[model samples]
Target: MSETHDHSNEHDHATHTHDGKPIQEDPLPSLEAQILEASVRELLIEKGVISADDVRRAIDQVESRTPALGAKIVARAWDDSEFKALLMSDSDEALMAFGVDMRPTELCVVENTDEVHNMVVCTLCSCYPRPVLGVPPAWYKRRDYRSRAVREPRAVLQEFGTQIPDQKQVRVHDSNADLRYLVLPQRPAGTEGWDQEKLARLVTRDSMIGVSDALAASDIGG
Candidate 1:
């Protein structure tokens, strides 16, 4: 196994282990739990802090797909050398190329490297590039991933079917602040003169999350 990150003292799974036998945990919460949850919602509604429409809108926003927009930006970066340079320097401009702008928050930075890989994890909470990746999956929100990734990124990547070489460096990003991150993975081999549409297929959600690299031709039968 290769070392995938820097140990310069920068900033910064598994299963339900029960008794000897396999003990199935409670699948559903008790009736009391549901009632309590409902009561909380009722109280919040009564206080007028949030309305049904607001809740529905929030749900709709998460369910909406904005992946294509980000895909277009990434595809452009794959092909255009000048744009890639601009992206490394100014991500907001790079993102604007795909019409995805991070206006209020300019702290977001896109880091790129050849040997070491980058991945973003908000272990404390579900911090994400909602405008680009839309909403995050449930697992990314868990405290386990957020706490462990910054410590043992290699192990986390393995679970995602991504294993870094012992020689390579792995940089696990802890998105503990308002600054968000997007990975600019290395272009996979055997993809010479490939078009944007073809290249977009290689960029999986895992690649964006930093757990896995972009797909190479061999992996996708190219």
Candidate 2:
């Protein structure tokens, strides 16, 4: 006889861990790109254009960014309509209220509604809002994703398991030069009266990138 199952229970059992360390079963061989980067960095240091301390500080800054910063802003927007309105109106100002240091970069917040679905891409390169959403995913930097996202967004999103309704219009925003786009996904159902911390848990990096929707209540054990 077939048995009823709680998929969440199975999910818990399938958790993969490495004892709080990264698992590097097979390290990648050095590539020409890596050599090029090293050469350029050393050249800059030798020329006194940038110091080794500058390089270390840059790496540390990049490592400090995480998706949690974006999630907090998303959760606050979900909780306050005024904040949402301000965010959509002026993302830089709205982000400043949350103590997000955008500095010298422009951010545009796009809202996902019942009638419109938004997706972000960098046609040229991975010019993302690193201060807010951390580093862009590896797939986000792929040529296939960048090209296909603008050409066939529906199909692209479908491959990511984000099927927009037939009636909804899919809008693709390309990040170029200085402007970067962030998707403000609609709050998931069955999460009414939830606090910002709890709501933040529903937000994911992909959702902010507009590749997927926010997690549902059941998906995160509401």
Candidate 3:
């Protein structure tokens, strides 16, 4: 279930629409946070720090980046070994090809192996890789998940309908402000000779989040 090790900095999705638009689950800001944000925006506008048009453009850009972007990265990794090596080692450099900059924080890519299954959680707060994954789910930001994920991760996975094999070791990674984790899910079998586009379709936001495996060939009627 859980292991005792000095994994202080060990780390690091689930459901989502397959289209370019990723569903934001209860993404509304709290009243207090909203008020504070509005006040800050007004102050910035009043001081000429930023114009209203700038805000609109920024929002558009953020919304434009979706899980599809993450899917493309995962697909390339599955198809090309060279790209996978670069993604695992130099994520920032690899992500630059997608114009994603993990500024003020670095991305730690974790791979799910035959013996180990990886899951990511932010114990203190939700520090996710928004540049690629878009917004975090509402359940992710809840107190229940933050506490239970480290304490009873297997149970949590089961709740998400993911049942791991008994022989596999479940390792929970905790994400912090400076570092964010992304799970590079193991590609399914029977996908040999598949192109990147076909492979990308198998990659889901949930798989990259480590809550589930990538869509199998059978799932896609392949």
Instruction: Tell me, by lDDT, which candidate is best.
Output: 2
As for candidate 3, its clashing pairs are 12-175, 13-209
| 147: Cα error in model 2, Å | 0.6
**Candidate number with the higher lDDT (1 or 3):** 3
Descending-lDDT candidate ranking? 2, 3, 1
lDDT per residue (tens digit) for residues 115-206 in model 3: 99999888666878888899888778775677678888899899998999989999998895688888999989999999999998999888
Which digits, one per residue and each the tens of the lDDT, describe model 1 over residues 75-143?
778898888788778888777656676766552544446677888887555678777777777677655
Error of 1 at 101 (Å): 2.6
Candidate 2 Cα outliers beyond 4 Å, as residue runs: 1-36, 43-50
Kindly list the per-residue Cα lDDT of model 2 for residues 4-65, writing each as its tens digit: 23433432211222222221122233364477789999999999999999999999989889
TM per prediction: 0.73, 0.80, 0.83
Better model by TM-score, 1 or 2?
2
Model 1 Cα displacement at 73 (Å)? 1.8
